[model samples]
Target: MGELKLMKGNEAVAEAAIRVGTDAYFGYPITPQSEIIEYLMAEKPHERTGMVVLQAESEVAAINMVYGAAGAGKKVMTSSSSPGISLKQEGISYMAGAELPCVLVNVVRGGPGLGTIQPSQADYFQSVKGGGHGDYKMIVLAPASVQEMYDFVETSYDLAFQYRTPVLILTDGVIGQMMEKVEVSEQKPRWTDEEIAKNTPWATFGKKKDRERNIITSLDLDSARMEQHNHHLMRKYEEIKEKEVRFEKINCEDADYLLVAYGSSARISQKAIDLCAEKGIKVGLLRPITLFPFPEKEINEMADKVKGILSVEMNAGQMVEDILLAVKGKVPVEHFGRMGGIIHSPQEVVEALEQKIIGG
Candidate 1:
């Protein structure tokens, strides 16, 4: 609720989770994001706020623990890096199917398989397209700075509970490892026990005390039931598509070209925007806050006014696909990036824009 103090993105996320009254946290240590677990272990939310915090055996165990906690109608969360997130896929799919609400943070590292310990934004498609098996959507928030990481921790919790779905805070090594100023609020109680008992009937605390016995399972054996479940999921996705999209616009009104980016890559893109202006090039940027429920409609509208779109990212071209889909054939859409723990600098992005939009 106040002003900035220097902190790391991982620290901000861990602190934010505690401040927002998270009921439980389950996690496995992964590079970059491991500090989150370290913070929880050191702070001991249980002693201070009575929140549950546990270090799981592996990424798989951690996500399933989140499943158990969320099913019980308690606000829960977990954190991991790229490879760990990949391991959580099956559990994520089940959570989505059951419409359980929870928060997940991926402090991404380079990866196709143990790619590197350095920061990378390569998980764009996995997060946005539903990393697990099934036609499900997760509300994905991409944080570009340490402050945004703090903000997203609380926002993600709210989105999950409001939509009765899982939400992901998609960040990378640069944001996770770098330190920056942050403002965190005083601790607030999230929910009353009465509120939990009243709202969360599907929780698995056993129905022996006159409460209706609730079974938390994603498996709908009957064909008709499965179809109904799918329909319900589709409806939720449509609602999110309409209401949950979030993006940042910078001088787009007079832009001749648009630069699309997110997470840490967008931070560099902002610098490039300033340089483009200095060089007399009219360019703008679209920084997506919600990577899932992508800011497609907004980009589509901009496509009509702009001559071209450039997607800048740490990965080669994951998010570019979505940008292209949004702009379609209305304008030229291209991609510029680096990978394997490398980052795109402002100078590099500016150079790409010159060749692609300003000249060739």
Candidate 2:
């Protein structure tokens, strides 16, 4: 077993990054997630693993720093809450367009503009859809517990490098601030310069004598070349969708209704499912772990059996659209949520299912 410790989700992410041999982290502090940077600073991982942790002047600067380090084949990460994440979108799009690998953590807060410090799942559209200009998609992982926060840093980096694409850890402030026991992983050594060169031949780690110079940029002036690149990216995305869709199902085989959710909402929905069983409703749950590569195939299969589907979220009906698409109207799809940092309760979810799907 791994070493265990009680920690907040944000702190777990920081510790996990250090344990996973992350080369560098550049980020600006923000509410509900400042603990990420705070933990790193307090731990002083520079001395421990030679991991560089810098609090940049702003969120924009921090994301660009990630772009620079990732371009050179280093394991880099950055974290911010909702507003701060908005600042980093262009950089994220740039990294995606350049086909660079990096891990990004968004511990989401409620917001259209500085709405609240409380948790939210409102960033669903932004994380999975291309938030910035151009056609792009980020591999989004939603962690429901502190243990997942600790575990997903390495997982995000692994997927990032494996596909040469940016990956997002899309959690919220509830998990970010909540304390729980985590089985921390053993520390891994950072990659050497030689190892980096050998593993990432496409990286611009200075001009190598054995290969052609690699230039890292998203800009392609020629229309034909840009179109070709877009097609290539689409193919990669299709491959990811086929191979990486991840979800968890509970009591699904005998469900009369289904609850679709992710992140903190998934945790709540689990309890809701239990409540439903006690009421003899026989509801099941489908919680997406990878929000981008959604478990569409599973959802589609369930459509034929379930009477209805309810998307329980912290935002106004963002993920329900995807559920609707997946079901293709075979079952009624409805959304139940509380907005502006308000977390809906298990009872509320049960009521919503009864009213919106079961009766409506």
User: Which tens-of-lDDT digit does each residue in 1-360 have in candidate 1?
Assistant: 586689899999998989999999999998989999999889989987888999999999999999999998899999999999999999999999999999999988887998999988899889999899999999999998898999998899888988889999999889998899898788888788778877776777667578668988899789998999999999999999999899999989899999999989899999999998998989999999998899999999999998888999888799989988888789888889889998878999999988876665
Give candidate 1's TM-score: 0.97
Candidate 2: global Cα-lDDT? 0.94
Candidate 1 regions with alpha-carbon error over 4 angstroms: 1-3, 208-211
Candidate 2: which pairs clash?
none
User: TM-score per candidate, in order?
Assistant: 0.97, 0.99
| Candidate 2 C-alpha lDDT tens digits along 176-221 | 9999999998999999998898888888888968778999999999
Clash pairs of candidate 1?
A: 1-185
Who wins the TM-score comparison?
2
* CA RMSD per model (angstroms): 1.3, 0.7
